[model samples]
Target: MATDPDNPPAEVLAALAAMGFKNTYSGGYTHKDRGKVLDLHFQKDGTDLFQGWKAEEMEANMAAITALFSGIGITITPRVMTLAEAYA
Candidate 1:
């Protein structure tokens, strides 16, 4: 099951909320606003980036997330974006 890193399903977000993960981001599928920060492409725009939730958010709900994802046979492991290249 390949899931989109940019947009997790609403159902999943809903479940996450039921399990105690709350956020004020765009549809709960994005990180908090990175105002005035350059993106990976060096663009000084798009403060509200979208690429699923932030790492810290996941870290805070790892146990619940892992358990939920595992139920669907999806094993998720969190790692640094730069360091994740090694695993690839």
Candidate 2:
């Protein structure tokens, strides 16, 4: 999720909480002038959920996506790696 910790929307927080996720740590992103963070959560059944939000605010279109996946108990686990980090 591309979001600032200070002002995450209510819906975002609630959905994350319901999925049993907890924010572990985050890092600063100089290029984007935004704080890039990694949030981790685990399900007892060992499911994975990964999604991203890049817009200024939660756009109406994207909101439906999470809801649809979340309702079905689907977690989209993405393979996250930076180009530099991966090549290193």
Candidate 3:
């Protein structure tokens, strides 16, 4: 695991991209706040996810990511940013 949040593990980034999560604010940045690891926003627009990703796909994708994270012993959890918190 990379110590830099802007550049997390390659596999983590890949999985996030594959899951339609946009790197709105890397380095765990979010709406004037900073946490750890990364801040991946799923929907740039209100309730609008990436094309072809769809709402239903999130479950499976998340499952895969969870598995991958578990394999790597990553216990970092993510949160959903409000529309006002996300990028405009």
Candidate topping lDDT = 3
lDDT, model 1, position 53: 44
lDDT by residue for model 2 over 1-88, one digit each (tens)?
4445456455765666565555555454433545554443332222223454334323443354466567767675545699998799
Write the residue-wise lDDT of candidate 3 on 1-88 in tens digits. Answer: 3245655567767876776666664344334335455544443222344444456565666676688788878764758889988766
lDDT of 1: 0.52
Off by over 4 Å in 3: 1-52
Ranking by lDDT: 3, 1, 2
| TM-score (all chains, Cα) for each model | 0.37, 0.34, 0.43
lDDT of 1 at 12: 66
Q: Top TM-score: which candidate number?
A: 3
The deviation in Å at residue 50 for candidate 1 is: 23
lDDT (C-alpha, whole model) for all candidates: 0.52, 0.50, 0.58
What clash count goes with each model?
0, 1, 0
- Evaluate candidate 1 by giving its C-alpha RMSD to the native, one decimal: 13.3
